[model samples]
Target: MHTSSARDAARIRVCHIVHSGKVGGVEVAAALLQAEQHPSINYQVAVLAQLPDGEPQAIKAPDCVGHGLNNPLSVLPVLKWLHRNAPDIVVASLWRSVLVGMVAKLINPKRKFVIFLHNTQYKNVLDRAAHRLGFRLADGIFCDAPATRQAMTAELPLETGQIHVVPLVARGGRSRHTPEAEQGPVGAVAGGEIRCVFWGRLAKQKRLDRAVHLLAELNNRATVPVRLDLLGPDEGELDEMLRLARSLGVEQQLHWHGAADWGRIRDVASGASFFIQLSDFEGLGMAAVEAMQLGLVPVVTPVGQIAEFTSDGVNALHFDSAAPVAERMLSVVGEPPMWERMSAAAVAEWSGQEDLSTAFETVCRQFLANQQANAANHVIRGAVS
Candidate 1:
């Protein structure tokens, strides 16, 4: 119901297309951006896959569209939808969505397309080709981290001018910490319960097995008892990680809480003293940021844009995947003062300048300005003709 000025009446219509409507950091980010878009802009969302009946949905974008395409020819419906909607700009949030957007742009050459890079690495040949084609056809590119921006330019041979490094907006505010007394009768630490938390999908790329191994090694060396709380959705590699933990004889020290709701995940994180992310590569490390916000010192691999928000011995404790991860974790666990210092720094980092609202507004204004310029050029050309 918001309106714009006469000069701003040419509202930029933006559509965010993603592969799935399921809940995750990327989906949450898209939903946040959609909800926070300026009144002058027209926003819509389209998911390549449809959500099931009675599933809890988080998207607030005005006009959510879905295409239930299960086959190779399923892309046709998406292309047709794009043509019919004819948005002034389309932003694809994932690889498959990028491919759909590229084809849609190819069919309707007048519309502009943009790709938002959310992952740290790209390997699929089809996805790479589609991304390249999309880049060639896109008017601009938005990356969630500076490292990602650099990698994309190096990998695709694109100019720096075309790529923009817009860091991921922190979706949640400061988290409330739970006191030790309020932890709800969890076992005493005397039995060797050193609670460690890991949040992300249980996929091979995440290296969940490596995390479990690190926890097992910690338990082996600890004079006191220790336990690891592995929280996330079990996909392809969950069973492997569980079996590895059992084989190492540390299964008792590890607990699988399955995938948790965002609120519950935050609550679980508040009570834990440490968080670990063992991803082979990442774009922005959203969960790490969230964990830091909740006062959990993170022990993470220096991949993707992790170094942007964290530094070794500062906001976070960093470890290289090649080195002894278990040894690195032990060093922090053994030093109480160091752990406390890192936890304080982590909380401070989250409170610093990573405001999502400011970043979202900047991008929208830039998009609107560019659209208006293009419209002015068209008018000038028509007058001349």
Candidate 2:
């Protein structure tokens, strides 16, 4: 993919390589960064895997390159493509993309390699090994949260200025009112019904089963009816979660909306009482931020970067135990004033975040300029010798 801007021909060109073009946080962030249209930079995405149809993406059609990774020979074309385009900076997101970028760097050592690490912990031994190798070859690094930066610093041999924490802000979702919009004095819920939402892959780490349990407990305690909307594609936990919901007799209350676009999710969640994510771990909890933008107070465990922005009882509710979280839900259900305050606070918290695209452009431009200086200095030393 080439940036055909003749006026901006001298601008820094960046190629972002991703493992896949799926609708995940990493992919979404890459898409948002491309949409920023930084004046000094031209951005394109090279997806390692074939892009599936109908995925809600902000990336321009002409600027994206996708090649399916089924065959071992698949990477050869990507390497060839890199050689043809020769971007000034190659930004690799995730470990898989890092490996691709490493090969691209080896092919042409002059190009700077930047690694974007999204998670605090590795998924397995293979992931750990890839991350170690990727970081070793990276000229600069981007971390989604301060927690991820600290974790990578301890695990990898990284210098202080190499890592930049640029948390992803909500970009795609549609919100009708501003955070300062006046919420109902009584509460967001209406007609004795409380609607809750959870969006992300339906996986074990997300603790959707725990959310189902909380739903049952909340229904038992509150006089109103509580419903939960489960969004995102299933990641092998649907069957088990469904069985649990059946056993608990709350299957009727749980609505499953798989892999929805941002607008659809926001539309479904507009009047929802709470957005719940009981995940065991997270980097920055992008979905929760999106939920907050929709004016739904978050009920999340204080894990990952979630603890940094969310103020329990002020902006959002915190989770320690399912029973306790359910109790808090009931408390809010009864106290309409408290519910209104939290709803407004949740939106306000999201409103205060930095625009992700602007932050990323600043960080990436600085990283490239610094790397160019180092290269020039090395050349000067060689000439002196």
Best by lDDT: 2
Indicate the residue-level lDDT of 119 in model 1. Answer: 75
Best-matching candidate per TM-score: 2
Please list the C-alpha lDDT of all candidates, in the order they appear.
0.69, 0.75
The global Cα lDDT (0 to 1) of model 1 is 0.69
Instruction: Specify the poorest-scoring 10-residue window by lDDT in model 1.
Output: 183-192
| lDDT for each residue of candidate 2 in 1-385, tens digit (9 for 90 to 100) | 5566765777777788886655678877776766666666777777777656775443435244545644455567677767777787788887777778888888787788888877777777877887788777788888888877776666566554567777687542321222333322212665578888888878777889889999888877777788999888787999999899899988999999877765567677775788899988888888887777667788998778888879999988898877888988888867878888887887777664556666777787777667767778779999999
Model 1 ranges with Cα > 4 A deviation: 1-11, 37-41, 53-62, 72-86, 155-161, 174-192, 321-336, 367-385
Clashing residue pairs, candidate 2?
none
Model 2 scores a TM of 0.88
State how far residue 70 of model 2 sits from its true place (Å).
4.7
Report the C-alpha lDDT of model 1 over 1-385, residue by residue, as the tens digit.
5454553556667777886655566776766666665545666677777666544345534254555534455477666666676787788877778877778778777777779987767757877787877788887787888888777766665433446666664544421222444422111112234677887777777888778777877777767777778776666887788789889888888887776656567666655667888788888888787777667778888788887788887767676652366665567667767777777777777564545645655675676566667778779999999
